[model samples]
Target: MPFAGFYAAAPFAWRVSHLASDFAMAWFKGWSQKDQRRSRTVLLSGVAGLAFIGVTMKRVPPGHVGLIEDWRGQLLPGMYDDSGTHWVLPIVQHPVSVRVYPVKKKLVKEFTTKDGKPVEVMLQMKMAPKIYYVPEIYLRFGRDYGRSFLEQEGAIDVNSVVSQHTFDELVGDNADTEDIVDEIVSRIEDAAFFHKIKLRDPNIVFRDPNADDDEGP
Candidate 1:
């Protein structure tokens, strides 16, 4: 098979063909026996290089950012790659992808109202890391930022707002549901902002705890 054909069989064959062509001329060169052996060595080394690139090269899909980290778990700052192909060093470095698009998260918590009533609250929100702060976000919160920061911190704010309202102000026919949801979202947005996450249109649903009670109303 042609040398290009050999490269064509590699995992990222289509992508690596241009790379293989750069060194392939060595195989067709006129040389003495010793020089031919040297050429073979160089050609083999080129193949190895191509393989290394195939293994280390990473492609960050659309709407995502990629970061590089070493085996020691250290991230290289200011070197994040936007959507496209990039090379991560072999063996010593690997790729970490963080989605830049909004991610929807649902949080359920039981909170005690000012009237001491237990209300099951379901909060749903869409959030995404600020593009410029993605590296810092990963550094501080790691890849699971949604769970580590958003959910944990957001829950606190949610409960705080819920605890301030009486059961009638939160869930009954007299409930000011819109105002309460707005307050919860406002508090969560503040928390999310400090953590470098952008929150959008957070919503809440309340289920009456007494609805499931065996006793008749």
Candidate 2:
């Protein structure tokens, strides 16, 4: 009779054990889902915080102009001058530095003068973009106006002017090289004025063709 009673209770005991196991598994699954949600929220919040900081802070150095370009690489209309610190959207916009201070460049070229003699002339000049026309300069020349416009175009103008004068007229005993320099400076200043560039205080030197030379003026 005792053995019979034990067999009858075994099935009931197995059902109770199975129910308890299912309850435990369901509770654990619910707790895991909650943890996953909390982790995701924290990760998204961190990314958003970083993006906000990046957009709010910007710096522009002294003696420079800050030009802003959009993500599509288009320059904005506004110009920033004499800057120390600035603010803009970091990812959507970028800051470009343009030096407003006077920039110097030297040009040395061999030209055949009106008398057919090859003369080497060296010239130096100081130039800068007008403050009020910074935006125009940026629009017309981009970031390399100093080299592309001033140096390259200036060289061509210098050669054209020198070709009109003979070697004797450039450096002879009665030659006033200063007058030539002044003329060249005036022409450059006039040409660049429309483009928002200023040329100042040009100085010219004539190098001896017989001397050993390796570089320009």
Candidate 3:
């Protein structure tokens, strides 16, 4: 009888142990589901936030051109007091480049050579916008003039460069026509003083000449 009771108690203990394990496993599964749901929600929210930020960045669209940098190192639409990227009211402003130019010029003018003979002079100068002159040049000439700062100015830009004294200065054989031109250029540069243009080295090509016939004026 005691042996029979022992066998019967073994089955009872096994059933209780199995039931306890089942209950623990079910509770564990419930907890896991809650944590998984929370993690998924957090991940989705992060993705959405990143997407929103990317869209905003793309939408920034460049604003009104507070300043523009040209190929010649000149700024257009006018020069700026400061340099680097700038910010402005949205839709109120933006920047754009309208013109770009190389660093070279061809000029023609009439003047008295050293011998007091009237002659036509031609010049070819290789230049670029001075890093310093952009602001003033843009303000005065606007973007168009700033684009080809020399072109817009042209020869007439220095209307009085060849002064009455220019002829006299060349008459005494003390100064050559080229030297006089240099003086005129110096004065023009001094007067305008636009920082945008660089009057680098100049090459003189005598385009044409009318002999004085060796006759005294």
Candidate 4:
């Protein structure tokens, strides 16, 4: 979750307001009652403005990008807010933060090898959505785009690739499983690219499904 800018700015606003109030009291001490009340009202209005600004602005943290969406669930085009504080309408517009940093996800699939042995294969991948395509990504997959699209498509590709190789070819000393992993990664990368996700450094490990608790990916 992204932190709202108001929380960090509120304290500063509070201190400024306090200083202004103290100064106002000192300055209005010798003034007429009517004039003092009017001046105090102005001070209070300034404080209220500060509070409103604090509440309306949101912070987009490092390694993340922000999108603006309207109250009617429609994304505003070309409204990308980068890493910084941005002002957005409280009710009419909403700011959405999407992580651009790579996140690690592990996919485990069970399938039969070409030699008919049941095996479990685990694929580990690091991926992140492209910052520029965040709006489109959010529209298609919501916030959980990785799990919704990448993982689903990756699992299908992994199953398809792993089932083509025999158990010996998968686990043999001279086996070129790197090529297999590369193939699966390529396919997944291509699929994820269409959804604006960048897949990186994917690895796969195969293990016997009937074995007793072999647990390292």
TM-score of each: 0.73, 0.67, 0.38, 0.71
How do the residues 62-138 of candidate 4 rate in per-residue lDDT, one tens digit apiece? 77788888999998776445646877899899888877899887877687888888878888878898888888988
lDDT scores of the candidates, listed in order: 0.81, 0.76, 0.51, 0.81
Provide the lDDT at 110 for model 2.
71
TM-score of 1: 0.73
Q: What TM-score does candidate 3 get on C-alpha atoms?
A: 0.38
lDDT, candidate 2, 111-163, per-residue tens: 67778887777767787888878877877777767666755667777777888
lDDT of model 1 at residue 26? 58
Cα RMSD to the true fold for all candidates: 6.8, 18.3, 22.5, 5.9
Query: Which residue runs does candidate 4 get wrong by more than 4 Å?
Result: 1-24, 79-83, 109-118, 163-179, 213-217
Residue pairs with colliding backbones in model 2 are none
For candidate 1, write residues 1-217 as lDDT tens digits.
5687667677587567866776565555666779878877987999898898799778886778888989999988755456468878878888999988998878877889899999989888788999898888888888877767756887788788888888887887754788888887888888888878998767788888767685776
Model 3: per-residue Cα lDDT over 1-217, one tens digit each: 8599889899999999999778756655756787867766886899898775554331212221235444554443553332244433233343433222335567666755444446455656665444445455556666544335444453543334444444445433554756656765675465335455656565554323444555578
Candidate 2 lDDT for residue 48 = 89
Off by over 4 Å in 1: 1-36, 79-83, 209-217
lDDT of 1: 0.81
Whole-structure CA lDDT of model 4? 0.81
Count of steric clashes across candidates, in order: 0, 0, 11, 0
Predicted structure 2, TM vs. truth: 0.67
Worst-scoring 10-residue span by lDDT in model 3: 56-65
